[model samples]
Target: MGQLSKIEWTEATWNPAVGCTKMSPACQNCYAEAMSHRLKAMGVNGYADGFKLTLLPERLADPMQRKRSTIYFVNPMNDLFHERIPASHIRQVFDVMKKAPQHAFQVLTKRADKGEGFVASYDASHHPYLAL
Candidate 1:
């Protein structure tokens, strides 16, 4: 997760948390998991847990720190709406996105049911750009 990204859909990627369990056959070739293993082997701090559902609180405020406006692919490496992530933590992530409107936060979760439930309860007025 950094200010610059090669992903065509967005300008940058921000991982408030990383790592996820395989949800389906599509996840068999998970680039994130493979990369996390490599990062863990290389001693990169965040991947220490190596594809486990690990949250990085320090990275939460990353977008707010950058002066330039950007399109942030939030949690591109992991499912933010994964069952393992707490409701409060999900709210916290949304809260950060709400506070930083200069940036557009895109969240795509394989857990559509959980994602829908969260969205139904979340105040859309507060987070206009937090697209699920």
Candidate 2:
């Protein structure tokens, strides 16, 4: 899972997983949902469920090897804090971010409560790269 970016804020986008179900009004016209269905039809490997939650462990370490200082938009295709995702996997993602201190990781989540827990679990000094 090499870095490939389309947005201005980040140098690249990485999806450890794809496919996400709508959870709030903000998801009414989710880009991921549309993209997932299209990818599924094209026989892309990760979207078979078409917006159902899925995990991609193969992509977990993507940030560690990037040579440049980058801004990574974590899980732009889905919410990392979704209940369906395991805490252990979330921690792995965090661990990668911690290791890649040269990169800035922006994690946005509609699940605010879960986001709070994520922040509380980490040592602030070790994860200076994470931003809400």
Candidate 3:
């Protein structure tokens, strides 16, 4: 767990999900894809599926555990909004983030086109902790 992240924008990083498909030329040298294979070789518990779309529900609460307010780069290793992932699972992730208001979550996705509607439709009132 990096309380201090090497990523320029965020203070910490989190990956509740991992693995992605090569969608464009930008994905040719994906660091996450390479790292996922290495992590799998190292026998990391969450990487058993190795570059396949795997959800690590156990890691969802990582940000909440940190008492200090911080910024988390959510799913830096994968696109959390991938179309292959269930909408319900994405909601589960949002639910976890909703409970941890002390931290800010940064989720970037190339597959936003597929999930943006769902995000727009989510009831923000019911989840005050989440920004959207």
- Give per-candidate clash totals: 0, 0, 0
Higher-ranked by TM-score: 2 or 3: 2
Per-model TM-score on C-alpha atoms: 0.93, 0.90, 0.86
Candidate 2 lDDT by residue in tens digits, 1-132: 356787877778878977666788989989888888898889887778877899999998888888788888899888999988888888888888888888888888889899888778866778654555
List the RMSD of every prediction in angstroms. Answer: 1.5, 1.5, 2.4
Rank order by TM-score, top first?
Answer: 1, 2, 3
Name the 10 consecutive residues with the lowest summed lDDT in model 2: 123-132
Task: Give the whole-model CA lDDT for all candidates, comma-separated.
Answer: 0.86, 0.82, 0.80
Q: Candidate 3 vs. truth: CA RMSD?
A: 2.4
The order of the candidates by lDDT, greatest first, is 1, 2, 3
Q: Higher-lDDT candidate among 1 and 3?
A: 1
Candidate 2's C-alpha runs over 4 A off are: none
Candidate 3 has its poorest 10 consecutive residues by lDDT at 123-132
TM-score of model 1 relative to the true fold? 0.93
Tell me the TM-score of model 2: 0.90
For candidate 3, write residues 1-132 as lDDT tens digits.
434688888999888888888787888998999999999999987789889988877787777788888998888889988878888878877887787777778888777676577778776665654443
